[model samples]
Target: MLFLNELLDELQSGDYFLLYVLVSAIAISVIFAIIGTIVSMNKLVFIAGGVSHASFGGVGIGFLLAYHFGWKNFIDYSGPIYSALVFAMFVATVIYFLTRHQKRYSDAVIGAMWALGMAIGVICIERVPGLKISIESYLFGSILYVNSLDTIILCILAVILSILFFVFYKTILSMSYDEEFASIRGIPVNLLYFITLQFISIAIVLSINFIGIILVIALLTMAPYIMERFLHSMKQIVMGAIVLNLIFCICGLAIAYQFDMNTGPCIVVFAAIIFFISISAQKVLKKA
Candidate 1:
């Protein structure tokens, strides 16, 4: 009763923004988790990793251009962030199309792009002076400071992506399982693959502000992989990943609030714990 009263008081006092932030974080997590699962199921985790890393270059380029032009009025800092997302997606699509023929060397291509992106970001950041924000936050994530605008954008993207995923569920699953078969069956394999790549890019960018680029891949891939070990269907896997994501988001945010820890790393730590627990449970069940 006392706890309820305090909660009510917090809600009445606008402390509910914390709850909003928590929900938004979970939603963002869910989006990445779904994208990660999609890519992983299609045997494209490395490609996704490459795209995520390459996005740093996009960020650097965006920042460099905006900073040099003194384009604060025209391009908000976050605008470059979106532009970087577009650039990264474009690069991913090109890489995907180029490597579609030389399937064996896909990883090598991804690795080269990843390194180049990082180098570009480094040079861009070094050239800039008196930039108040830490680029590291974008690389790793700083979830606790998420504003309402970020939350809104995340929610909107998640909804749109979810709808698209649902409508094209069969095409996506078909492409994942056997692209050649999908193509033979007239599934528009190339178009579907391109769409998936673009969506993955957007998902990665959306996640950057929450988990940082370094750990974002883990949050995206790990939750779905762990869930897939137990869940049979793709639907179950996605749902389980979303639930697990929500659990981590809430627990991480609460702990961060209570202890004054950084939000992004804290959420990843919580997710790691959950992964361990799930693994242990699976082992115990197998033994029993």
Candidate 2:
């Protein structure tokens, strides 16, 4: 309680930057909650990780192109975000089509793509001459360094995702539960699935700065998974996951601040602990 008071006091006493960081953290959590629900419901949680790693290739490409050709517009911080979006969408689309037939080999394919993406990123970064870039932020995240523009972009994305969710709730629900039934009913299963992948890609790309690429998948899938253990309805799962994500993000942020630690790992570590606890509790209940 005292720590909470002190943190609130610090934020209120002109540390508006920290306030922005907190807002960004919360917004990313909400975005993750929404995307996480969709990913888990669709059973594409692994794909989320694949898409995220694939985005690193895009970041490398963006950096290379920006430095070599002097694309000033693409040299900004958001440049990698856009680049990753394109790469992620492409990867997601490819994976979607490839896995359509060989369901058994989907994991193998995704694992290959994951490794390929990171390898490409490393090669690109190494091959580029006179290009100075730190992969630390992309790998481990540095949410505290987020600026106002980043916050605004995150806010816009959150709103867009919410609106999309509201508009396509039924379509998404149907597609998630049973693709065959959705296709039978002419729900445009392929189209909707593709769109969902794109959204997941976008979510992963945007969240890279907030949670880093390596840990972003955990944020995207863990909360929803946790909620699923308790909730059966999609709506309930979404709402529950959002609340859980919010609590986790805030707690992680507060702890990071107090300890002067890295926020991304802290958040992931906290979430991992909660996930283990939830699983243990479930086991105990099942035994009873």
Candidate 3:
């Protein structure tokens, strides 16, 4: 009852920042669940990781361009996310073309891209004159600081990703299981693969705001993988991932509020704990 009353007080106060945080959390959960399911099905965890880091190069470039164009306030306007989105898309495309037929070398190429992208970012940041950028925010994330624009963008992305997956569910499934069979069925395999990469790129870039690039892959992989251990169907796995992610985000946020801890790491740490618990449960069940 006391907790409910304090919650009611916070609600009655009409905190717009709190509202934004809620919306961002909800939208991001939806996005992460869908993308996590897809990426896990496709087994493209490395691709997601590569794109997440490669997008950092875009952040550095965006910062440089924004400053040169006399838009010092651009960074606060979510310029880095957009810039990274473009770069991520490009990186995704490059990875697809180069690795489509070279399964043996894909990992090596991806590693190179990942390292080069961050190196480029480091150089760009160094070239900026009198610029005070906190790499930690970009490295870790600052979900509490998301503004109205970001919340709106996340809502739109959540809708877009949901609609795309719903309408093309079988097509995505077919491609994920057997690309040659999907192509034989006239499912536009190449186009779908390209499209998947783009969506993955978008998911990675947008999530950088909440989970940060370093831990973003965990958000894309952990929930889906956990669900796959117990769930059978794709839809079930997606729904389960969404619920689990929501639980993590909400509980993590509450703990962060109560303890004045960093929201991003709190959420991540909570998810990690749950992940290990799930693993232990699975092992026990298997032994039985």
> lDDT tens digits, residues 180-248, model 2?
999999888888877888888988898787788899989898999999998898888988888888888
Residue 153 of candidate 1: its Cα lDDT?
A: 82
What residue runs in model 1 are displaced by over 4 Å at the alpha carbon? 1-11, 15-20, 73-77
| Colliding pairs, model 2 | none
C-alpha root-mean-square deviation, each candidate: 2.6, 2.3, 2.0
Model 3, 23-100: lDDT tens per residue?
788888899999889899888999989998988998888888887888877755377778888988999999999998
Question: Ten consecutive residues with minimal summed lDDT in candidate 1?
Answer: 1-10
Candidate 2 CA-lDDT value: 0.84
Top model number, TM-score: 3
lDDT of each: 0.78, 0.84, 0.83
